[model samples]
Target: MNKPDVSYSIFQDWRANRGNIKAQFILSLFRLATWVRSNKILIILFIWYLPFYRFFVEWVMGIELPWSLKAGRGLKLQHGQALVVHGQTIIGSNCGLKHSTTIGIRMNPDGSVGRAPIIGNNVDIGAHVCIIGAIEIGDNVAIGAGSIVVKSIPPNCVVVGNPARVVKVNEPVTSSYS
Candidate 1:
């Protein structure tokens, strides 16, 4: 992404997290860490800071948004509790994640880790949702609460149930984020 787009994304993140102190602090720290890691000279400092970041964000706050995760701008965290995301996961811009959501990689039978999900833009993930394995969640998708998704979903739809079947297609975004 261009510098302007990055800046816009940062601003959008700020807007998304407004009035949420925990989210603001965590996102700000994540941004700082990401910036530090981008610079070769600052990487050493980031190595030192990683422990504290993990302790505070994971242990204290109960959220596990790693700095290494490639998430786009306007990421919203509602409830901001028990939200875990895999490091290799790629989340698109304007995505909203609720509490107790897990976006993680699956374990192979050979005792190896698999790929994380690639969440597309403008996706709204409800609480207690577990999106596992090497799935691709397309743009403008809404996942219902307590859904367990293990497959790829097409764009512009609403999914529900344990296996996360598409309940509605061409669903319009109800939030002001888009």
Candidate 2:
């Protein structure tokens, strides 16, 4: 929602509730990258990720996270592997992204690049989930694993299956963090 609180320290959040080893590693790298972006004086620190960035993206983490992806505060990576999010994607606060999840873009009929998905606050995306196109996943939505989401989803719903149909609605919004 309202800019999703970017004041908190990502390093502290990772130290407080490090979900898994892979999550810790990825978050650490992401935090370092974010910090480097803010303070240009510390640009030398980016050299640490340059060599391993491709390896982590393709082999280890299996993610395609770019510096342009706008993520809110309290972002959590559950298993932290195979998560592909486009550069134009906007992820909300306290969102949990599991392994093998993809939030990518598609091409428009005019042969131009389409918009990526916009995920709202407190959204829990499960493993092996694919969210494509310019869909808007609303706040508090929980998508089950292996679901392929091609359409926009409303808030406070639980979606599952190949086409990601809403199985339940009006559920409580819960976060993985304490």
Candidate 3:
């Protein structure tokens, strides 16, 4: 029998790393709670109307996210409107995503087709950051108040402005969420 190529072998190895994938999922779920703490009011309201929102998102809105989808414990939504994430997007633990943050692939001729944004841990995405395309945001990335990200962000960095420029790097994020 012929052996698999190096690239093919690496792909197979990645596919077999199910344990790592599950660990990532669990971490994401834990992070969500911290995120919620940072934006407790919004989360509380969402909790209060969870049944309705659940019904709408799961049934009426036609936007489907599977139950098995792993998100960290501290996931907080400062505002809970006009927010959408691609199912394939890999969210890291303790990520804070505000309202109107659409992390998905844009369907345009100039846009790259397929694949979703892979977000890193402890990332704070401010309001209205439309992070489209197949981008990878590293850990501890503090996105500015309003920005559009289409490129990869290195770990321990801060990005701001429209089109999202990396104005600073390795700045500490001080959030109340734990």
- The top-ranked prediction according to TM-score is 1
**Whole-structure CA lDDT of model 3:** 0.62
| Candidate 2 lDDT over residue span 1-178, tens digit each | 1112222546544653465666666665665555555555655756666457556665676777775678876788876666788879999978888888889999999999999999998899999999999999999999999999999999999999999999999856466896
Q: Model 1 clash pairs?
A: none
Taking all chains together, the TM-score of candidate 2 against the true structure is: 0.80
lDDT of 1 by residue, 61-87 (tens): 999999789898889989999999998
- The order of the candidates by lDDT, greatest first, is 1, 2, 3
Instruction: Provide the overall lDDT of each model, using Cα atoms, as 2-decimal numbers.
Output: 0.88, 0.77, 0.62
After aligning candidate 1 to the native by TM-score, how far in Å is the CA of 99 from where it should be? 0.5
What is the alpha-carbon lDDT for the whole of candidate 1?
0.88
TM-score of each: 0.89, 0.80, 0.58
The per-prediction tally of clashing pairs is 0, 0, 17
Best by lDDT: 1
